[model samples]
Target chain A: MKTVAGIDIGNSTTEVCIGAFDDRGKLNFLSSASTRTTGTKGTPDNVRGIRTALEAAVQKTGTPRVYPEILLLNEAAPVIGDTAMETITETIIMESSMIGHNPSTPAGVGQAVGEIIGIEHLSQAIQGRDYIVTVPERISYEAAAELLNAVQGMVSVTGAILQRDEAVLVYNRLRRKIPILDEVAKLSQIPEHKQAAVEVALPGQTIHMLSNPYGIATLLNLDAEETRQVMPIAKSLIGKRSAVVIKTPGGNVRENVLPAGEIYISGDSEQTVSIDAGAESIMAAVHEAGTVRDIAGQENSNVGHMLRRIKGGMKNVSGQAESSIRITDILAVDTLAPVQISGALAGETCMEKAVGVAAMVKTSQLPMREIADRLQAELGIEVRVAGVEAVMASMGAMTTPGTKLPLAILDMGGGSTDAALVTEEGRVAVTHQAGAGELVTMLIQTELGLHSRITAERIKRYPLAKVESLFHIRLESGEIRFFEEPLSPRFFGSVVLLEPEEMVRIEEDLTLEQIVDVRRGAKKKVFITNALRALEIVAPEHNLRRVPNVVLVGGSAEDFEIPEMLLEELANYRVLCGRGNIRRTEGPRNAVATGLVMSWWSE
Target chain B: MQTNKPAVHLYTVDETLPAIREICAGMEEEGVPWKILRMDGTARGLAYRAATDSVLESGIGLTAGEVALQMRKVAEDRPLFVFADPTAEQYRMIGANAARAVKKKRFVTVQAG
Candidate 1:
């Protein structure tokens, strides 16, 4: 019979299962066993745990057999750069202020310079001459009214340029409504004279006067020469909001060019490539250089060697590229080139830094090859590791049952909680967060001050019991019976310690009732708190309402009160909650291992 | 004693008299032999007695290990089959311990049909 072994290396335990094909091609479960996992669960170092679990299963089955024909193992899924990347992205989005890009031409004519003030100065400034007024963002309608009242007779404020969102606020504040232009990027630059005819363009609309030469001539009431003079202003205002073209009496705008050079590539194969083609495209060509496509459409060895040769040549030339730039020396990272790097000098080598320092110097930046070499030496791992979440999701999908395709699984282990939702089409979305069983255990241990983890686990698992009197006591299992003799003085009036051997006397001061309450309260705080946190993190995008069924199979799920508590807590969602039948049908534990074997049948 | 017809009787303790009489009277109409085994404290003593008797009578065709396993199976099937007036704490502790034991034992079907 062809037998298959499935192994799951978990944080606290390793579970294994053996299955053989019966005469009818049905999977017959032979045996299953669990052993405490040695080393980290998901690491290659967990091989020892896998070996121990396999031995235990073999012993239980009492079958002296060689390694099964096929062995299926759950690939270790590790969190790589997700949380850090998320945090960095969020920080950048929040802190960024100015995001400027030069528009080809801006419309509007003439310069308007004046003291920037609120709408109150508008009436006074509009009496005879033009003036510019600034509207601060976030000021409400009512406040703008009072400010206008206070500045009734101030200097003439002919026109106003408001910040984003301030346009609506100021307009609402005015008793009489005026056309407001929103999202004025260069509001501070508006010149004084053109303020009246300068209709401010709103956020959604384009620069009107700039788009129409006839409109600019009519609004500014300019002669042919004046119209000509204002033509540049109109052109500059083409796409700008709140920008003033100061009639720089003698000012002219000209384009400046920074020097750029071609990156030359030389290899044993005499292949020339352009740096302007983009790094990814270049790398794709480099990777496929010498490979030839077979009838099966797969690259053969000849092409593979060519690609390797190019990669090797590229690594050697990277140093030369970096030195020629005369900024920071570059090296190619062995593991994950093209994604990350390490450098002694900051600005020039990094893309993010390059953007920041572009105004200072025009230094030539080297190709990615140099950066990859330096990263390989420093990080020990590859420069550009594959996305950890993506890898785990693919591996998890491969090991899970095909019939239950598109299923979501939460690996609630000790160090981290990993959740993967696989689609029927084979796409997988995965997320990972810190805090799970270990965190709950830590909470219990800290709260109870339990000396042993065994004791803490026991406390977490059980309800409570209290000795009512010498003659009788109440058990949490809903049992009450008369003692053959009077209860021992040690057990009376306090919660009895049920540890094997070493009976310690309970404190006589506390009543049995008080002890029961304390234990229940403590367990509730620790277990429930951790469970909710784990659930929230695992399914963050969707509410619990969407997750209709939750199959809990973990070390913590074995706790007596935990399952009941979870059932009650998740009752609102009407989710079907219970232990996996895999353990019941075969034996306790080894569900993941069994699933792995079953996955082979599916494939 | 010489008659071929079966006979039925009901037994009751002072504390459980009302409940016992209600159940016995209900069964008596159907002409079934019903008895209430009562004890002073919790129902645990009665359950223990019942379990012990059931184990002995059922032990005729099974090994000692099989007898114990069967007893546990019966207890799981009808939890009230082995009733105990346990305290809140003992209820929590023992229930949890028993569950842990069952889980550790890897019982295929904890509650026997």
Candidate 2:
């Protein structure tokens, strides 16, 4: 009988499994440990993390540190993942456009259109001519209402614009109630004398007229072609409580088409594909090129910058010369990037089509043997390099009681998605592809224009809810949650990430539906796409239908929804798919590490 | 004279007791000098007093629920502006002012809800 330790070093974490081989010839599972990986996978710096994980496992199991008969380490692959995004579309306003930014407190309901005029000038204005008063902050709501009341019949005040949160107050005091719009942060930017339309929907309702382009056209007297041009502007203002559209001569909306540039794929033959062809065509071109050796973006275009950034990252991780690193696979997903409208008074954003790419680069073979030697020397235990990571993972996956032979395992980690198939005869086939958890995070941050990876990560991990009222929040699924005490005022009008312990506020003014859409879409794009791609490569005859059972084992398999998403995707093929329960107790994690000990036991 | 000198005071109607308690507790922890002044008039009447009363200048007053349009009309320069008890939706409607006050912990100084 002998005691053994299995250590698996991954992109994001290091895991360890401890066990003792009984005289009965079964490896008895003992304890396991995990810690954040100290450095890039397949690098010598990983030894520090491996040692820490082993120490934890040994301490937990109360096994003598020097008692391990041997230590087994996974022969981690040399694949590296890098992600990038480029905007393909942008909204350009040719002239000063209307402000539709929803102020939390717009006053009154209903639509009104009239020429813009200052509140102070209301009393002196032409009689019987309709006007929308633009009230500056210096004028108190009472004073503005009093002035409007004095000229109520003499000068027609059809509507009012306010620069402060006193919309309700000012609206209540009006002798002749007109639709009032408030919280116009840039009140100074509203061009005076221009025809403006104000629309405020009642509580629990949305403004339909101002949110429509034709509505703005009718108010401003625009022709058919002009109305067509305002659709993008109108689309962005949808679902707001209030909106403002001003008429500016020669005002136009344009779509800014950014140059996506060319991508060079060097496989058996060198071929170039333009990213402008979209994701489908570009992928087709990549498939046609065959046995991809490397991919590079054009010299100065966005794709070029993206590829350079990837190569730079690989160089940093491997300490390899730039020339030795080559991107082996590229997974490109078509995505829409929301770019904020420049100079918009209300925060308006327009969707632009773009490609989100996760590239896998191959470096010079990693010296895992050197790492194993150093770890063995430090721990005073004989250490041996184990089978390929995919094979070890498949072995660990089989420990799940109900699993059978002819099974496939999907190992989705932070940087890559890998799959392996093991037959009853013990023949193993494996494949590694780019795009996983990290890629999903990149897409979320890029598509939402969050600008903060930390915030994007939180959004990816948590559910979302819109703070509709102090006592209640409407979740993405339309379920309402009520709080005993009032929630913090800062989270009052914004979507918040619902964490287990507390509600984390997302700084962006996005709706719960919009944020959830970005997050779920990103997960589907990366994990769902990569899962199918990796399985196809490892399946017999490259046909997934032949693979009967698929068990997920890795860090990403523990994601709240990824396993379910994969099961739904694989159901069409009638393939059994679920997260692995290694040893009937240990979760999807530590699979490769556990498998290492099993391999030695069989030997 | 020193005792008679006007300091930033917190005045609230009976309806805003819950919010006032929290604000006072926070203020106490920060070591800021504060006094609770009781209002004995209507919401609108309080605003008029804040605007004209010399000793009441630059203080804050908490109203019952929503700030009437009348209070906003007169509270522009009154340090004794009435602060209404803000619902989540109404607080968001007020926007930047509420955001700043909440972030800066100047909860007592926020304008009428």
Candidate 3:
């Protein structure tokens, strides 16, 4: 009887499966475990994670620190995924000419155009001059309201900008109601003595005049050139509740098309495409190149620097020569980078077009024997480097209930998306593509303008909900969840990720549907797109319809929505697909590890 | 002056509540109309009874020692929020959130500390 433990080291995690052949020659998998991987896969550093995962699996089998008779390690996928974003367009505001925000409690309604004046300067104002009072944070609501009331008869104060959260307090006290914008942090930045248009939409509505370029031109009395310059500012103000546009004739908003430069794909033919051409054209060029042998970028350019950085990164990781590394696949996605408007008083962000690229890197080979020898020496056990990752995954996938010959398996991991197919005659075909979980996170981060990558990652991994009230939440599926106790007030009126234990608030101001739409759109862009590409390469004669059943096995396959999404997408091609349940027990996990052990006995 | 508009009613036994300004500002920020009046009674009992009598079906009974947010539809014994010895900030949140209940919007978190 041989007790064997199969270990699969991945970019993000390490998984272990312990199995033993009984005296009757029947195999039984005692337990499976997973832990965060210590370092890059296919390295000697993986031994630490391997030991942790093996110990966890051993604990599950009611044992304490028992090394298996033999350890089977998967030949980790050779592909390395690196993602970078290149800004194609930048929004440059010339001066403090715009203010756009959805302050939770902006007061009053309708639009007003006036000369921007400080509250203290109101005492010096003359009659017939329309003015907007800028109230700094130091001015109390009562004091500001008293001043506005005192000047109402003398000066035509059409609007008010408040630095503190007192727009409603001042608005409620006013005799003649004027549109008031509050929570303006940088009140001093609103260009002094300049003509500005301020608009506050009615509750539950967005500002129309300030959001439209032509409307802004009408309010500020701008000519054609000035109107054209404010288009990007107006674009950034869309869907905002309140906005202010100061007319500076010198206030130039330039939509500069940054020189992102071109990438060269060397394969069947040398193909060159500029990253500034956006994702569609870049992807077309990459696809046309047909099996990229190597990719290079122009010197001193954004794409060029990105390529060199990733190549340098790969060299550091695998200790391989930079010239030998090849970029096999590139998933280029068009995304909006939230570039902060330079001179805006409010911290407003305009969506600028950016190319987000995740490319797959691989060397001719990885030194798996070196890692195997180190692990064996440390554990004092026989450790063998197992079969190719995809083939072993296919063997483990067969342990799933009701699975038969001629099966295709898709392994979606953190770094790469891989697909493998095994025919009835045992002929295996495999394909590895770039862009998986990390790419999806990049898309979410760029699209949502979330400040932190951790926040973006949480949004990618969890479902979202809008905290509607103290006790209830409206989920992404429009299902209402009412809690028995009062939820935290900080989460109220914001979108939150529905984690298992607690509600984590998302800081972005978006509707639940919009956030879910972005999340799923990102998933579809990366996973669904890569799914089709992978299936085509591994399917019979590169035809998806010829493929039979598909079993999804990977860390990403266990994602709450990915498998269901793939099943729906693959169904269009009439392909049967579902998340794999290895040994009818482990759900879409430990496949590569379990496969390693099974393949060892089979051969 | 005609006070016929629908508004959240704030009732207090003593006329000298220092937290009234904070509470009023909180309600005002949400663009909700409100009225504060002197009522001689326990905070909970007055808020419970006043909730059904107010035009907006939302009422807050405030005192130096306690505060309560009551809704007309909910049972009088089980008010929405009843805090003992709430700070000024808590009173403000109670006022804003009670108005929010009337407006059918999400309530702000009432910090106990």
Candidate 4:
């Protein structure tokens, strides 16, 4: 009997399959283990993680970390850019005066035009001159209401911008109703003596005057040239219930598209596409240049810098030559990332269009022999670097009880999408494409304007809920879940990611529907697009209709929604596909490792 | 027990906690008219009665040791929040939350003083 271990060191994890085979070559699986990959895959740094996985399976009470007689490792596919996701466009706001805030409640319902005056300066205001008083945070609601009531008789108090959430409190005390905007966090930054227009829509409605450029022109009496300059401000405030646009000198909201530069894709012919042309045009150019030979970008441009930086990072970690690194595939998808509006009173953010790119890179080979040699020397065992990622994956996929030959295995991983087809005639075909879980995460992050990737990842992986009340939450499915114990107030009135342990609040200014739409849309864009493309590349004649069974295997394959989404889309082509169950035990995971051990029987 | 007058009911443990005045002022400042009533019970129990008895279906219950805010027909054990040894700021929030419930507005985040 020979005891062999199969180690699949992936971008995110290192998985090991330990099993024994008899003289007749029938394999019996003994145990398996998985650990977080310590470093970039296909490097000597992966040796520690390999040994850790082996130690987990071989550790038996005091028996000094035993090693398997034969160790086989799957060749890990590395995606360029050390990290796969990159945003091609960045938004820069210059000399802007835009405050786009969505405070849940603002008092009154009308448009008011006046010169803004701070509460401290209200006492010295001239009579008959219209003024919009700005209330700071120190003044209590009662104090502000009393002061506004007292001062209404003196100056023409047309409106008010408040630092605290006391708009309703102050509005109720006024004898005459006027529009009021509250919860202005950066009230001090607002020019005190500038001409401003405050508009508050009725309940269940959005502002009309401030959100429209002509409405602002009529309210603030701006000329045609000045009115055109504030177009971005009006466009940003369209759906807000209340908005305040102050005319600060030289304050202009200009949407500048930072030069993202052009990407040069070379196959049989060279194709050049501008990043600013957006994802669709860039993708068309990519498709035209089939089998990308070596991609380049305009020198010193954003795309160029990004490609070179990614190449540099990969070289540092993999010790591969800069000239040797080859960009095989690039997936570009249109995305929107939130950019802070300059001179915004409330740290308002606008979602700006960006191009999210993920590229697949192969360095001749990532020197898996170095990892194998190191593991062999340290463990004093025979370690052989064996099996391509897709081959190992398909061999492991066959362990599924009812699965048969002529099957296609889809390994949806973090950085790359890979597919392999094992024909009934014993022929094998494999292909790798860029964009996977990492790209999906980038889309979610950019579209929702989530500051952290972890938050975006949680939103991508789990279900969401809108905390309608303290005790109840309306799930994305429209079912209301009631908690017996009062939930923490932090989640109140916010969209939260329903993780296994707790409800994590998504702090961005977004509705539940918007978040869900972005998440589902991102998944569809990445997985559906890559799944079809990968299938076509590996299928006979590149015709998906000719393909038969497709088994999904990888970390991303375990996503709660992506499998159903991929299956639903694949139904059109009449291809039978679902998330793979490796050995009917591991749910859509450990495929490469399991297949490595199974490769022994094939030999 | 008439539900005609829509006022956020305030039920306090003792007649003079001094914090009750601030709570009443909070609701009044928010422009929602309120009526104060004295009751002796646990904050949760008093909040339940206050919410059930009021026309607006919103209530704030205060005991010497804790403060609780409730809305009628919600889970009795789970009032919006129950604070132990709540400070003056929290008492004001209790009033604001009850008024917000009546106004169909978002409840202000409650913080202990």
After superposition, the stretches of candidate 2 with alpha carbons farther than 4 Å from their true spots are A22-25, A63-66, A268-271, A319-321, A447-451, A463-514, A601-603, B1-113
lDDT per residue, candidate 2, A1-603, as tens digits?
A: 888999988889999998888888777888899999997787778989988888888888863454567889998877878777767777776556677756655667788888889987765688667788899988877788888888877887788989866776676677788888877777877787878788888877888887788788887788998888788768767877788877777665567778777899988888888786778887887788888888988988877887788788778766779999988888888988877777766556667788878878778766788899998888788999987788888888989879999899999988789888898898988777888888899888888889799998888788888776446788877899988765665565677888999998888656667787788889998898888888888888989898879999998898888899999999988889999999898889888998888998677
Clash list (residue pairs), candidate 3: A489-B109
Question: Who is ahead in DockQ, 2 or 4?
Answer: 4
Per-model chain B TM-scores are 0.31, 0.42, 0.90, 0.90
Report DockQ per prediction, comma-separated. 0.01, 0.05, 0.36, 0.26
TM-score ranking of the models = 3, 4, 2, 1
Ranking by DockQ: 3, 4, 2, 1
**Which runs of model 4 end up more than 4 angstroms from their true locations?**
A58-68, A78-98, A118-130, A138-155, A192-194, A247-249, A297-305, A467-472, A480-494, B1-8, B13-34, B40-91, B97-113
The TM-score values for the models, in the order shown, are: 0.36, 0.81, 0.89, 0.87
> What's the C-alpha lDDT at position A112 in model 2?
83
How much of the true contact map at the interface does candidate 1 reproduce, as a fraction? 0.00
List A-chain TM-scores for all predictions.
0.41, 0.90, 0.94, 0.90
Specify the CAPRI tier of model 2.
incorrect
- DockQ, prediction 4: 0.26
Order of candidates by lDDT, top first?
Answer: 3, 4, 2, 1
Q: Write the per-residue lDDT of candidate 3 for residues B47-95, one digit (tens) a residue.
A: 8866877888888888778888886755666777888887767877887
Q: Mark the 10 consecutive residues where model 3 chain A has the least summed lDDT.
A: A485-494
Best by DockQ: 3
Model 2: how far residue A418 lies from native, Å: 1.1
TM-score computed on alpha carbons, candidate 2: 0.81
Q: Place model 1 in a CAPRI quality band.
A: incorrect
Candidate 1 vs. true structure, TM-score:
0.36
lDDT agreement with native, every candidate: 0.40, 0.75, 0.85, 0.82
